[model samples]
Target: MLRARLTLVLGIVLLAAGVAGFATAGRGLRTTSVHVGTVPVELVRPDGAAAGGAARPVVVVVHGYAGSGRLMRPFADTLARRGYLVALPDLAGHGANPQRLTEAALDRDLAAVVRYVRGLPDADPARLALVGHSMGAAAVVRAGAADRSIAATVAISIGDDAAAATRPGPRHLLAMYGAFEPSGIASTTEATGAERVVRVPLVEHIGVLFADRTHHETARWLDRALGHHPQRPVIAAKGRLVPGGLSLVGGLLILIGALLSGRTGAAPAPPDRDRPGLRVGAVLVAPIPGELAGVALAHALPNTVTGYLTGYFAGCGAALVAAALLLRRPDHPARPDHPARPDRPDRTARLARPSAAALARAGLLAAAAFAAVVLPVHAGLTDVAPHGPDWWVVALLALAVAALLAGAHALLGTPWSYAAVVALCLPMPVASLIGVAPGFLALISPLVLVLVGLHVAVCAAAGRPWWRTVLAGALTVAWPVAVVLPVLG
Candidate 1:
C-alpha cells in the first residue's frame, strides 16, 4: 500500500513537472514545420514578427548525428526570442529526411536548407549565421569557411574537421564545448584558433545542447557578430527541462516498484542446469563474437544511424547465440539405439510464452510510458516519433532485443545477472561502434547506458516473469532508437 501511494503521488508530481517544463521552454516563440525542397526544416521566429515586415537575421541551427531539427529547440528558441529567425533542418538520414547520411549527402542537404532559409521573405540574407553541434558543427565550419557570406559560425563539440577548416576565415568564429567533453574535442576546437573558444562548465556533449550558458553564450556571440542588439541580451532559464525530465524518470521507476511490490506471490524460478560461474562467464565473454560479427558486417551497411543500429542488433543477436551455446547442457547418457527422452521446452520457448493478460498489461504499460517520455521530449527537445520505414525497423529491432534479453535471463536465471553483464559489456560495443561508425556515436554512449539501466529497473519492478519484462523492455528501447535514429536506404 505504501508503494502504491508512492507511485501515485510521485508519478503525478513528475508528470506535472514534465508538462510544465515543455510548456515554458519556448513559450513566446512561434515554431512551425515546413519543407525546404525535399528537406524538412523547423522554423522558429519571434511571435510578433510580421509576415512582410523588416527582415531578421537568419541563424541556421544544425543538429548532430542521429539528431533532428527539433533536438536543437533550446538554441532555436533562444535565438528566435532574441529577434533572430532560426531554421533547423533534419539533415539527410536523420529525423524526417529519407536520404542516407553520407558526407556528400549531408553537405548537399545542408546547403539546400541554408539557401532556402536565406531566401525567406523575413530573413536578412546578408546577416546569416550557422551554429552546429558535433557532426553538425563539422559541417557548418566547412560550410562557413567555404561561403564568405556567412557572417558568423559557432561550432560546438567539433571534431578534427575543425583543423582542416580552421585557416583563412575572416568571419567571426566561436568554438564552444562542454568542459566535461573528451580532451580531443578541446584540442580540435583550440586548433581552429577561432575568434573565441569557450567551454560551458558542468555539462557534457548532449547536455551542452540544452545548457543555459550555452544558449546565452551562443545568442550573445551571434548578436555581436551580426550587429544586432536587443533591449536585454540576457536569456531566461531553460534548465527546467532537466528537473522535469528527471522527475518523469523517477516517477516511472516508482510506479514500477509499486507493481513489483504489489504482487501477491513470488513467481517460481525457471529451471537452470548451468553452474553460476559458467553462466557468469558466458555473459562476460558474450561480446567478443558480437564484435567480430559487427566488424564483418560494417561495410555492408550504410553509414547512417539506422545502419549502425542494424549492426548493433546483429551483434547483440550474435552475442545471445554465443551465450546460449556456452550455457547449453550436455546430453544425458542414453542407450545406443534410443535417443534421450525429449527434454522440456527450451528456454526460448518459455520466454516466448506469456499469458494473454500479462502480455496485454505489459503492452499497455509500455505504450503509456512511451507517450509520457516521448511526447514531452519531442515537444521541448527533439523529434522523437517513428515515421515511414522506421516503424518497421522498430518492430524488427524489438524482436531482436526481446530475444537477446529473454535469452540472457534464461541462461543467467536472474535479471540482476543480466544487468551486470550489460553494464560490463556496453563499453566494448560502444567503442567498437564509434570506431566503425560516426564519431558522434560516442556522444550518445551515456544515453545508451541510462537506457539499459532503465530497462533493468523496469524488469525488476514488473517482475511477473521473464516474458512480460522482456517484452516491455524491448518495446521501450526499440521505439526510441527507431524514433531518434535516421532511416537510410
Candidate 2:
C-alpha cells in the first residue's frame, strides 16, 4: 500500500513534467536562458546554441499581463520547429524579471528583447516578427510601429486599436480573437497583407496560444511574410501535452483501485440528521464569510504577491477555525448516576478501521480529481497565478499542501475536512481583482459551490424526502450561487 501510494504521487509529478518537456521538443531547436541587463529571457535557437550560428529568421513572443514566458511555449515551439529563432521573455514584473514593475518598465523590457533577438548571430534582421497576447498586444503593436526592420506582427486578441496595430505594420499583420470577444470587434484585412482571424471556438484570452487556429494561421503568415517554409509539415508535437494528462489519469486509477479494494484507512461515519432549512441556509450563507474574509485579508496583507499569498493562507486557517467552532455541537451535563463505559474489543476494531481510511481515501480522491482537471486547464491558461514556476516545483508544493490538509482532517471532523478543501480557493476572488492573475474564481466557483452544496445534502440527508430536497437545491441554484461573487465584482 505504501509503495502504491508512492507510485501514484510520483506518477502525478512525472506527468506534469512530461507536459513541459514535450512542448519544447523539435528537430534541432534548443531552448536556453539568457538575459539583457535586468530582463530574463528564453532563447530558442535552431541548433545546439545561438552562439556562432549564422543569422536566421527571428520571432519574438511576449506574454500577456501578469503572465510569464511559459504561457507562450506552444507558440514558440511551433515557430522554432519551422526554423525561426524564438525569443520568449517575461516582461517587467512577470516571470523571472524585475519585481518593481510599471508600464514604462514593461515597454523597455520588450524593446530589449527585440534588440536581443535582432542581434543574434544567426538572426535575419529583415525577417524579424513580433507577437504578443492581451496586454502584450498593445506592447507589440507599439514596438512594430517604431521598428520598420520587423517583417511582420501578430497580435492575438487585440482590441479596438485596429489602426494602431495594422497601419504601422512591417509588411504583414494579423489579429486573432476568440469567439466570445465583445461585440463590434471583428477581423481586419489591409492591402499591405494585413488580416485577422476570429471565432476560434471554446477559447478565451488565456487560451490564444493553445488554439489550433492560432498556431496554423500564425505559422502560415510567418512563412509567407518571412519567405521561409519548413521542409516538412509539423505533426506529433501536440503529443507532448498527452503525457502529463495521462499521468493524472494513472494517478486517478491508483486511487480508485485503493478505495475499491477497501484499503481505506478509516471507519464509516453515520449520516447526519436531515435538516432541509439548514442545508439551504448553509449554501446561501457560506459565501458571505468566504468573501468578506477574503476582502479583509486583501487589505490587511501587504500589496505584494508574497503578501497576497500570506493573507490567503491565513484566511484559510481562520475560516477553518470559524467553520469548526460554528458547527460544533454543545455539550450537555452528564447524569450523576451514569458512567462512561469502554467499548467492546470487536466494536473498537470496527470503529477504527473505516473512520481513518475512509476519510483519507475521500480526501485523496478529491485532491486527485482537482489536479487532473485543473492542471490541464492550467497548461492552457498559464496566465493564472504564474510567477515563473519550475517543472516540479508546483507538484512538490502541492504535496506539502496535501499533507497539511491531512493534518486538518486528523484534528477536526469531516465538516472541517470539506472546509479545508475549499478554503484555499477563497483567495482567488481577491487575487483576480488585484491583477496577480485572472479567470480563477470566475471559472471554478460553480464547481466548488456545487461540491459544497452536495456535501451539505448528502451528509445531512434524513431520508428519501430530505435527500431529494438537497439534490434538487444543489441542481437548481449551484451555478447562480457560485457565480455571484464574479457578478458582484
Residue 466, candidate 1: alpha-carbon lDDT: 58
TM-score attained by model 2: 0.64
Candidate 1 lDDT over residue span 1-489, tens digit each? 576677767777776776676667667789888997778998988888644577999999999877888777777767777888999898887888877677778878889988898888899999999999888888888888889899999988887554335567537988888999987787787777688889889999888887878887888898899988764464643644564575557557555756756676745555565477776676666555555554554445343444554455556655655666666775555678975445543445454666788778878767755554555556556677765444676776676567667667656656554575365436543664457644555666676666666677767766646556776677766667656766554
Instruction: State the local distance difference test value for candidate 2.
Output: 0.53
**Model 1 accuracy (lDDT, Cα):** 0.71
List, residue by residue over 145-247, the lDDT tens digit for candidate 2: 7787778888776643543445546447777776754332334212223455445677655554577777888888888888886754553324434553565
Off by over 4 Å in 2: 1-27, 48-54, 159-171, 180-194, 235-239, 251-267, 271-276, 296-324, 333-489
What local distance difference test score does each model get? 0.71, 0.53
